[model samples]
Target: METSATVAFVVYALLFGWRLVDAVEGSASVAVLAGGIVAGYLVADLVSGLAHWVGDRFFDETTPLVGQNFIAPFRRHHVAPREMVEHGLVELVGNTAILALPPMALAHHSLRPDSLPLLFSGGLLLSSLAGAVCTNLIHRWAHMPRPPGPARWLQGRGLILSPERHARHHRRPFDRAYCITTGWLNAPMDRLGVWKAVERWLGRAARQDPR
Candidate 1:
């Protein structure tokens, strides 16, 4: 009944914490995962912009108007750029914690109890970092415009480990590929067609803008 604020805060806190964990995991590895996340954070605007532009450009007569309605309003109004940046990290932590559950459970239950704890713990942490990094990059990329603030410093590798790309997803939600750091897997993701549309548009734009 009275769970509104409590629920919201809890959700916010989890996102904030999780992103921190994601940032940490990303730091440990510097390849695709790390780069993706960093890309998400540093150039969220570009990534999301490309994603959105692609989505629009490739949209056919039946561009799945169903889901867009729910997402559009939320993107335009509810998602606060300030809160998401501050709280996004917490959500990342929560996500990693959730990811750790299977590994953690196995570690807790298995007889002889192998290195599940170490492996899964590492996995959980890394998952957060990877997700956050990817999420930030892919997210910021999708949103079109960058989030405002001195917090933009987060995009810089020196200060924040996570990517800024995540901002775009918040600002302009879409069904194509919602994740921040993992664009490669977008095709494998559930909405293969949508992701393809986004890619097609992006390809067209690249040919034209050459930016």
Candidate 2:
């Protein structure tokens, strides 16, 4: 698992680098591409939050296959906030990269970098993958006793999830502040009651509490 995860991480990293280079080289408007990248990052933030919220609120860690691999980790995470930091890098990256790698590979093969729609979507997809792939590292930084200088700088600038911001998630019930990447979308998503609406709809549809 570790080996495969490392290989996947490396492959995706190279692809992302190539995508950026292609976008910059092929783009007629660097400013527009840059905006796309920013938009992509924001999309990632929202996706991460939505995933986190679902994992935290929806299922138990014993629901068949997903229970062990996916649901369990979130449960463990809420219990031991720094537990993932102790895990090997391969485990970290592999678990997070699964959802991201395939779409990225498809984008690389299918999208033309010069086309505006393709370029923006490609940028958004890759940036979202970056945010997702690095989620564990960013979350760990939020718990580190003494995070490295660069991490501290990034956290301070709100470029990554900071310790102060993440601490709120660890509090009782663990309901709010679900986004663990850049956390740029937490406020708006929560204010809009998006997760609540989803839960309510799912419960009504199924005639059982989904939360």
Candidate 3:
């Protein structure tokens, strides 16, 4: 089944249909529906963070429950626990707000119907999926080392991802690149992607002018 947020966002968008109700004929379901989406996505992320926080705080497991072996290859780059907490906190806040902003804006002037369930459910489903997909993509990129040459150009746009830009997060291990996903997710997003791109671009520059 589609996650609650994914289903919810789609349904919320379709809320334009609620106009059929005579009582809310002029209402814009966008706000109410989107708000539900925002809330749903935020809740999922909150849950995930809570899990991570609890795991880190209580389990005393140095390795994650999942991806222990996969991430092992990158052990040379294991970040400090303090860094994880700081970066993770920034991610928690930024990601939650991103989901919340769209619907919150729409709600200010929206006209929703008496039956808010459709929009509510739809919003939750769509938003939930958004967090999952976006996070997954970013995490994937962060794990991979920078690709060579023209692929270097990707670093410029790679902020949409997580792992690729994460190297700087590893190097500094204290400040910046807090979020692996988007610039909006954290200033570190822009910093990480841009720095990686420039690093690659400089490599290309040196190769072309090698004296």
TM-score of each: 0.29, 0.86, 0.36
Give the alpha carbon lDDT tens digit for every residue of 1-211 in model 3.
Answer: 2244444444544453333233332346666666776676565544433333222222222447533532322232243323332243234234444454456335423644456675565566545545543453344444545533333454456524334445544464333343443323345334455434544665643221100
> For model 2, how does the per-residue alpha-carbon lDDT over 1-211 read when each residue is reduced to its tens digit?
5567557756865876587666675446576677777887887777788778777776676778788887778878877778777876667777766666677667666776776766677677777778788887888888888888999999999999998888867876456788988877777877897877787778744232223
Ranking 1 against 2 by TM-score, winner = 2
Model 2: which residue pairs collide? none
Q: Give me the displacement of residue 128 in model 2, in angstroms.
A: 0.9
RMSD of 2: 2.9
Candidate 3 has an lDDT of: 0.42
lDDT of each: 0.38, 0.75, 0.42
Per-residue lDDT tens digits for candidate 1, residues 98-170, read: 4334433342344221233333343343344334424443343334346445435544432432333333333
Tell me the lDDT of model 2 at 62. Answer: 75
TM-score result, candidate 2: 0.86
Which whole-number lDDT from 0 to 100 does residue 90 have in model 2? 62
